[model samples]
Every structure is written in C-alpha cells, then in structure tokens.
Target: MENDFEGRPSSEEAAASLRDLGADRQALADGVQVPKMLLAALGGVAAWWVAGAAGANPGENYEPPTSGWLGLVAALVIAHLIRRETGIRFRKMGPRAALVMAAIPVLCLILFSISLGLGSFGARWAVLLTSLSAFGLVTWLAGIAFRSALDQLRR
Candidate 1:
C-alpha cells in the first residue's frame, strides 16, 4: 500500500500537472534585476529625505504634508514597479504578504499623526526623525519581502 501510494504521486504533483506549468525560476530572477532594486531604494530614500526636511522646517508647514503624501505615493509606485518588473503580480501575493505591506504605511501614518497631535515644539525634530525612520523601515521591509518572495518563486 505504501509503495502504491508513493508511486501514485502526491497532491503537489497532481496540482503541478493540472496547472500545465513549469517553473521559470531564472526568468523571474532576471526580470527583477539589481538595478531595479537599487532604483527603488533610491526613490524611497529621496522621498523620506524630502518628507523629513519639510517636516523639520516650521517655516514651510505645507511643505512637510505635501512631501509626506508624495513620499507615500512614491513608495507605493516603486513597490508596484518592482512587482511588475519581477513578474510578481500583486494579485499573486498571499494574504500574509499583503497584510505586511499594507500595515507598514498605515502604522507609520498613524504614528506621525499621533506625534503631531502631542504638540511639543521641542519635539519637531524628533517627530521628523520618527516619521522618516518609519518610512525607511517600511520601505526596507517591503523590499526584503519582495526579494524573499521572488526567491521562493524561483525555487
């Protein structure tokens, strides 16, 4: 019975056969190159810097809010571009993966808003740093997740 079961092919094999597919590990890796990753990172950094600078300067209150929004937009765009270039569709993302990516920005925004509401002049620099750091952390985490997912897909 064990031998018969062994020879019959597992569920994974059955699924694989049903899909009529073969892995394109190398193609996937090639699609998402180092340069693209670097560009994404650079874009994230630029966004964070702009936000921090604007947030820190009281003279330009409008600047910080604008930059913060721009930064968030840029991060999402970069993430989508990375997904496209890597042949990783957003729809392909598992529920856990989607939650991780979505939570990052939402948490960061919440933190920033809470900090602003506290209202301490001396805390301006701290607020700026915190916000930028959150942005950077979230971006970095997303990048890592993307790469890891790609690696898995390659396998």
Candidate 2:
C-alpha cells in the first residue's frame, strides 16, 4: 500500500518552486529600478524643501531639518504607486518590518536634531547638513524597506 504522502512533492520540490517564484520576482524588480530611483529622489528633494519653511530660525533666517510631513506624504504616495506598479511580493512582512519602517523617519528626525546641535560648522552649514542628511536617511530607509519586503516573499 502506498503511503498517503508518497504522491506529494518533496521538500526539495518546494524549495525549487520558491526559487522559481523568486526569479520571477527578481525580474520584476529589475524592470522597476529606474522609476523607483526617480520617485525616491523626488521624495528626498521634496522633503528637504518642505523643511525650509518651518525649520528657519527667525533670528538668523537659518533653516534646520524638522519632521517632514510633506516629504513623508510624497514618499508614501510614491511608495504606494511603486508597490502597485512593481508588484513586489510582500506576502508576510509581519511586525518587525512594520516597526522598522515606522521607526526610520523618526530616527532620521533625531539625527537631524543632533546635526543641528553641532557647532563646528555654524548654523548655516548645520542646517544644510541636517536637511540633506535627513532626506538621505529617508531614502536610505526606503531602500531597506523595499529590500525587506522582497525578502519576506522568499520565505
């Protein structure tokens, strides 16, 4: 008599199927790179510009990086569009990835604050650094989030 599981695919077959799916996903990822980069860059610049208005110090007319709501909106919008257009496999991100994504912008804000306190470059340079760094961090974290989402699909 045949065992009930005998006709079922083996573990190796399951892994191979996953690899095939992963390759398909990789092909999709390759196709979206240009649009993704463009959108991310736009978000970075928009966020940097958004900070200029409120970040300004009336005494010296210097702007430092602050929480970037406008930029966040841009990034979130672009991220939504890209997710739809690219069809990245985000099957099971769970809590960890969600927490990381949530924390990245806050961490960037904290870093910007730290940069604002540095006196070595004076207020003007500090503001510039803070703005640029904050935007960079946002984009960097976006990349990490995308990669993490991709990783979740493979599992």
Q: Which candidate should be chosen as best, given TM-score against the real structure? A: 2
Q: Give candidate 2 regions above 4 Å deviation.
A: 1-35, 42-55, 58-67, 88-91, 94-96, 115-122
**Whole-model lDDT, candidate 2?**
0.61
Candidate 2, residues 1-155: lDDT per residue as tens digits?
87565576789998998888989867655555434574467447545653463344433755444445666676667767776767553566656668768877666656555554554245555566666665776667666666666665545
The most accurate candidate by lDDT is 2
What are the runs in model 1 whose C-alpha is more than 4 Å off? 1-64, 87-90, 117-121, 151-155
lDDT of each: 0.56, 0.61
RMSD of each: 8.1, 6.9
lDDT of 1 by residue, 1-155 (tens): 35434567789989886565444555655566643454447435543643454344344353345666666577667766665665556345555556666676666666655555433355555656665666567657566556655655554
